[model samples]
Target: MEPDEVDFAHTDAADRKRREKATELARFAWDRAISGAELLELPDDRLRKLARAAGANPPSTRETWTVVADLLDQKSAWAAANPDHPQASPAHADEKIMWVKRPIPPWT
Candidate 1:
């Protein structure tokens, strides 16, 4: 299938959302790896061990690096297209929400 074609494999909305989130995280990881993050700079053997611990199949060094490069390219293109936009920060489960109390509701 062409890269532009829709992927029917992820037809479910939740699955698509999960895949999008995973891609974002992967891009962030790649950014850290290229920005002198010691953990991300670990050798291939160590990285493979870490992947195994996370219950993920370890990719070859070439494949991993290639993906990082592709993600970086995609990010760069997005930044170019939206020069004023800021990239979103990762969401936290413990984040707090503020509620506003109005004297009257709009319906009234």
Candidate 2:
């Protein structure tokens, strides 16, 4: 194995390890969110705050709300499908407030 090949192998292994760690963290977060441990009904401001705290570049306020709303809708659908499952009942399953904004027309 040449020196360059050894360096490349080390870099590849490090990158793979980082990716595995990220995947594990994501899976943990997902499980918590689905189990209702992590609240998903956060308003835009709170969402932004959380994102900033996590060192993440959050989307725009409108986009944040849209994504949360969509996730809630999916959770509700899952709950409806799995009525007997305990994790199916999300925190915002009963929320009726609209979250999506109307799209602007190109001609406007």
Candidate 3:
């Protein structure tokens, strides 16, 4: 294989693992939010502690969970209010997430 291809292949597993971990953490945070425990209400230190308790290894900070909680809350609230909506659940919208990515500035 070419050098670039080999490099990408090696990195692919790590990337996938990272994505999985992020999603898992997000899910945990989402559940907590839905249960009336808003993840964003915690400070960064508290979030990291909670994430560790939730099995996130190194633990994501509140800032990271804040973003996840926000998106999850939006989806959750909408789904609760509009039970008949086509895209009403995370399971139904997982594939659609890819299409929502916007180009980020290089600095970001």
Candidate 4:
């Protein structure tokens, strides 16, 4: 079977909206991450997953924040796209956004 590029397997409107929100949040967080902006690092991944949920082809996860900014900048032209969601609007831009980062133990 061919891939569902148009819908990507999602059909429900609610699911589509949820996915859109997730992507918006991800881009917002990505902008902040590469900009050296301070964000409220959530105490857990439960909430952080919202921002990274729609990442089908996210930047390499093996690297640390040290080189993520440089890599992301070159990988794609990710402008600080303003989100339509109220929470991500310019008014709340200063508010501490709850973002998540991978929580893998160093020892493997």
Q: Give the candidate number with the greatest TM-score.
A: 3
Q: Pick the candidate with the highest lDDT.
A: 3
What root-mean-square deviation over C-alphas does model 4 reach?
11.0
* lDDT tens digits, residue span 1-108, model 4: 457466534457745554455345445555444232222334224334433553533322222222333433432333334344443333333432434344578886
Q: How many clashes show up per model?
A: 0, 0, 0, 0
lDDT of each: 0.46, 0.45, 0.54, 0.39
Q: Write the per-residue lDDT of candidate 2 for residues 28-92, one digit (tens) a residue.
A: 33343432223354456755654454345554434333444455455657768998997764334
lDDT of 4 at 21: 52
Q: Model 1, range 3-98, lDDT digits (tens) per residue?
A: 899865456874554445445445544333322233344567755654454345555444443444456456656756876765532123122111
lDDT of 3 at 67: 49
Worst 10 residues of 1 by lDDT: 93-102
Listed in order, each prediction's TM-score against the native is 0.34, 0.35, 0.43, 0.27
Give the C-alpha miss distance for residue 13 in model 4, angstroms.
Answer: 1.1
- Candidate 3: Cα lDDT at 106: 96
Q: Is candidate 1 or candidate 4 better by TM-score?
A: 1
lDDT of 3 at 13: 87
How far in Å is the alpha carbon of 16 misplaced in model 4?
0.2
